[model samples]
Target: MNSLSAANTHFTFDLFQQFKTSKKDDNIFCSPLSISSALAMTYLGAKENTAFEMEMVGALHFNEVTENTEGRTTRDHVEKLGNVHHQFQKLLTELKKPTDANELNIANKLYGEKNYQFLQTSFLYYVESVDFKNAPEESRKKINSWVESQTHEKIKDLLPKNSLEFTTVLVLVNAIYFKGQWDNKFDKRNTVEKEFWLNKDTSKPVQMMKQVNVFKFTSLEDIKAKILEIPYKGKDLSMVLLLPDDVDGLQKLEDQLTAEKLREWTSSQNMHDNYVDLYLPRFKVEETYDLKDTLRALGMVDVFNPQRANLSGMTGTKDLLVSKVIHKSFVEVTEEGTEAASSTAVVVNVGSPPTHPFHCDHPFLFFIRHNKTNSILFLGRVSSP
Candidate 1:
């Protein structure tokens, strides 16, 4: 579990770096857990070097369960790989466990051409397959409907029109929906329009929700930042906010940010109970991304290239490769609580802080995490209201 958390931290920073570069000066949001889970299912069909590459890029940590018999080293490696997938399955199952107070759903599905020779027995555990050949548009709509249902209609049209062609062989998808009321709810009457600094020279009016309470908080002098953790009703999940001291200090903080650094900043020892006059903006963010180029940039190239790809594990042949990876996410934060949903589709053809007056009057980074597993469910930068 510790290793898995570490891997998630690393992957989160890696994806954040990419997003920072691509969407400069704009707000960004994503579900690293959703993407990783969906790709874990896709990874089931990867073999040899392809498998190794995917494992490394995905940052999936699997404990090695080795048999000591002679010539069993190779067998052990194979077993370890299988164990990795099993762990993902276990984690996904755990995440989907029912919680009445909080509505959380994580689901996976594989849409394939009707005649595609998919290994139903081996792959069934990871993803449920649906035929996409007979009616491509209908199949597309069906997948979208499933995403909608899974996300409580918070996410729609996940796979945009004309994005899926008739030639698509496989499409792997993972959708996650989360809605939790704050352990200490804020009064709606306290929300008021306030100035949100976009930068030194720009500002905008935002509906700022205010509350005064004792929260887990910390201030890092070295980083010029403050950290705060607000628990949701279940206590198993929380939002950790990181805010820079200076309104223009976000870029500097970003320059020094790392998975290890984040771990240290959010460490239990660093957080102490403190009275905080919290002011957060009421905002909604809906983001979509085409990750082919980004994944390739991260050295996940073979999976997207038909000529060099190796996915024989799925169909016992190299006839398929990922054509695109589409991801869509929605988030709304208000006085009551937070509601967020994200969907990641692997198209086949192929493929802070707080506190201390923790007034978030400027851009900042935040994460919705599952406390038990230490898995980051959603990550975003609120550059604007």
Candidate 2:
């Protein structure tokens, strides 16, 4: 699971760079965990060139493999498939364990056309038969409703009215909802309006929440930045904020951000428990992304190409190809804690905090990490908030 978490972490950095470059100066947020889970669901049915392409898609899917999944496959192909689904199942199972401190719900479900013969193997998500051919609209509603319910209604209308086509074969959906109270909660009375700098000269008034506490802190002397971790109740998860010493240093920080750098900077050995002044703005960010273009730009071209896709493991034929992937995420940080949920649906588609006088007055990077598993459930940027 740690390897999978690391792989997902690597993917998160790669994806952050893509969004950062494309949506320059705008707030960016997405769940690599959700996206990876959905893709892994789709990968269960991929074979031959498609399987090979996905497996080596720059650490896209793990090598655990899934043998004996539904549908008929050559002995060699089955051997190639292994236990990737089991890995995801394990991940889902582990993350789904009940926790009293946070309202966390994560679910993955595969909705497929009623007639396709699904390849049976380890089930990482609930597999449902839908009438995409006869009732695409109703099917879309059903999927959206399920996603909404899974995320405590935080994520709604995940699949728009026209999202599903009658010809759509398989759609994988992953939704993660988390509401955690800060361990050292801030007092609402301390929140006040303050200037939030979008840039050195440009700024806007924001409701800034202030607090003083001891936290895992580190100073990036080389990059002129500081990192702080504010744990949520139960201490199993923490929100980490990386603030640049210079008011306008986010770009340089982002340009230098990588999995290795993040690991080194946030490692326990580098961070120390220290008392510091902390100020974070009360903010909420919701963004939707049509990841088809992004994924293709990242060299995942063949899966979207019907002519090139070889997902024979699905129905034992090279007929299925991913059409579009849509992801919608919402997050709100207030005095109590944070409320965040993200839904990633494959049309086949398919955090942080501060301390240390660590005032997030300017654009910065943040992520919500599940401390025990070291899995980053969410990664985002607060450009304006």
Candidate 3:
């Protein structure tokens, strides 16, 4: 369980980097946890395929299991990622449970063709039966409808036209929705038109929300950036923002960020409470991604390649291969709160304002963190907003 957060964190950053490399100047957003959850369902079903399992685990950021305690490093140890089935289940429950303080919903399901014959999963997994062979169109609509309802219709047309052909046998879908109200909610009247720098030479006007409150803040002397934590109503979750000191310094900060380095930078000890002047722009980003290329680039090739793919663990046989992984996520940041794809808790008090100045008037990185587990649910960069 302890390593589960690490896994999610690692994968989150890994996927972020992949997106960063290509969509350098664009607004970026995705829920690595949601994608990991969907992929893990298939990983759990992989049986007797040590190589493929190792690839899946490694690409997913799964750490060393019990078998690798000493100096041992083999495919099997990676494959037998100690009690992973239990950990996956626990991760889902931990993310979705104790929801009163937070509005969070995570829905994961596996749909298989009814007429296709395959082995059952090891962990009493539930694979929803659908007539993909006979009614691919209806199955597609049905799957989309289920996901739409699961996410309160925030996500629609998840499976677009012709995505599910008659030959399609299996599909995995994961949807997450989160609503967070700032503990120290910003005043709407304070929001004013401000300049947001996209780059050294480019800038745009934005509705910047200003709030003077005591917030968790810290300065990175080496990187010349600041980190601030804005808790939602319950404080179980927070929006952790990283702002570069220079208008064009965002790229440098992002380059320096890694899973381990971020832990050190944002550790509880590093951040101190002080009166902060926070200026965040009101923005919303809804992105849909086909992650087959990204996953393959991260060393997960076999799962999508039908000829050499192996997911015997998911079923009793090796007849299943993922056809497509479509991820659509939405996040909106306003003065009142946030409606994003993520969750968490914390206690914050309203008090005096003004000492520290942490302005987000330029491209910045923000993460919605589950403070209890310190797991990041949704991470994105607002390059233009």
Candidate 4:
């Protein structure tokens, strides 16, 4: 019998827990299986395999237009979705080997490979930025543009189109670029605003951004958390933010997380009216990760066990070990709601705006939530966003 190490289990447990809590807080549901798949690919020595998941997802969102009304029947489109799901499952099922030699060899092959079009062809576009380790601005901008185009311009509108659509997006665009500002920025001109608390005793005249619109919101004493859902312009996408009342409540929520808890929290939320005296900073970031080694470091080894595992359905032979896992995700938050997009397919574009000032100032967990299911498509945090 084979098993994950204590440290590895702890890592897995922590990642799952964090994902659950954060997803719950954000009112978004991401497929745990997908995360597991990504993690497992890493464990099987398929360092690039994890990135494949991120980039593919990002690409899906990048080009995710309202399901087109073209001649393709919804049934046919569903079949395509089913085929993708089946292929993904096949990849996961094949990488379950338990031998060290098999696992290590697969890892070497995955890391050594250059042409990862298999992943791209599977609907994943990849991208990355090579910081001069000096982190030159020109290099950084070049890298940013590459990521933007790889995601099919569903991202960074500021980049030069030519310079932006480089191969880097094919590898790193879904890695995670986040930018946010408060829904209610503090104006130097009008610094005098009154603030109010739900409890009158705690009330101070605060600068509340007067807003008018419906929002998905909820308060849970059982969980000690407040959840808010902000929809994107397309309405297909949204940002769900969860704020734990106790500054330390996040850890507790993480520990108490479960599928049931998640379902409960999301279902309990309702549309409501809200007000806020919000002050938040505008912050920008870009993070690229090579999850190949990380997943290998985890405990998934079958899919990448090229020799032992079987994936004949994909490539006709057992030689196809997942070569790389690249992820790039980007988000921009402002007073006009939230806009974000991720790419995991060969190419795609995906995003939004807001009213009032929904300042996500406090320690809050957010998610890039899709409307269809309770599954968190993407999970994140705004410890400072």
- Taking the tens digit of each residue's C-alpha lDDT, what string does model 3 give over 1-385? 3566787888888898899998998999888888887777777665444345433446786544322334244356334543555566766787677655568887778888887555643434557889998999999999999989988888899888988999988887888898777877777777899998888888898999888778899999899999999998778889999999999999899999999988998887898887887889999998888898998878777778778777776555667788778888888898778753332222335555447888999899999988888888999999987
For each candidate in the order shown, give its overall lDDT on alpha carbons: 0.77, 0.79, 0.79, 0.39
lDDT of 1: 0.77
Candidate no. 3 TM-score: 0.89
TM-score of 1: 0.89
Off by over 4 Å in 1: 57-75, 125-134, 339-355
- What would the C-alpha RMSD of candidate 3 be, to one decimal place? 4.2
Compare candidates 1 and 3 on lDDT and give the better one: 3
Q: Could you give candidate 4's per-residue lDDT for residues 94-189 as a string of tens digits?
A: 432232211100110112122322332332221222332233345446655654654445445332333322222111222222222222222334
> Global lDDT for candidate 4?
0.39
Candidate 1, 1-385: lDDT as tens digits: 4454566567778888889988877899999878766776677788766776676555333222232223243245566566656666666777777775577788777777768667755675554445555566777888899889988899999998777777777777767777877877777777899999999999999999888778899999998999899998778889999999999998888889987888888888898898788889998998888877877777677887778788888888987787667778888887768752322221112112333689999999999988888888899999987
**How do these models rank on lDDT, best leading?**
3, 2, 1, 4
Go through the candidates in order and give the clash count of each: 16, 19, 13, 78
Q: How does each model score on TM-score?
A: 0.89, 0.89, 0.89, 0.48
Off by over 4 Å in 3: 48-57, 63-82, 122-124, 340-354
Candidate 1's displacement at residue 132, Å, is 4.7
The predictions' CA RMSDs to the true structure, in order, are 8.3, 7.9, 4.2, 14.8
lDDT by residue (tens digit), candidate 2, 1-385: 3566777787788788789989998998778888888888777778777777667766474542333345333256455455556556677787777787787776778787879776675432356888999999999999999988888898889887798888897776778788988887777777899999999889999999887777899998999999999898789889999999888898899999998899999997999998778899998988888888887776678888889987776767787777667777778897788852322221100022443578989998889988888888889999998
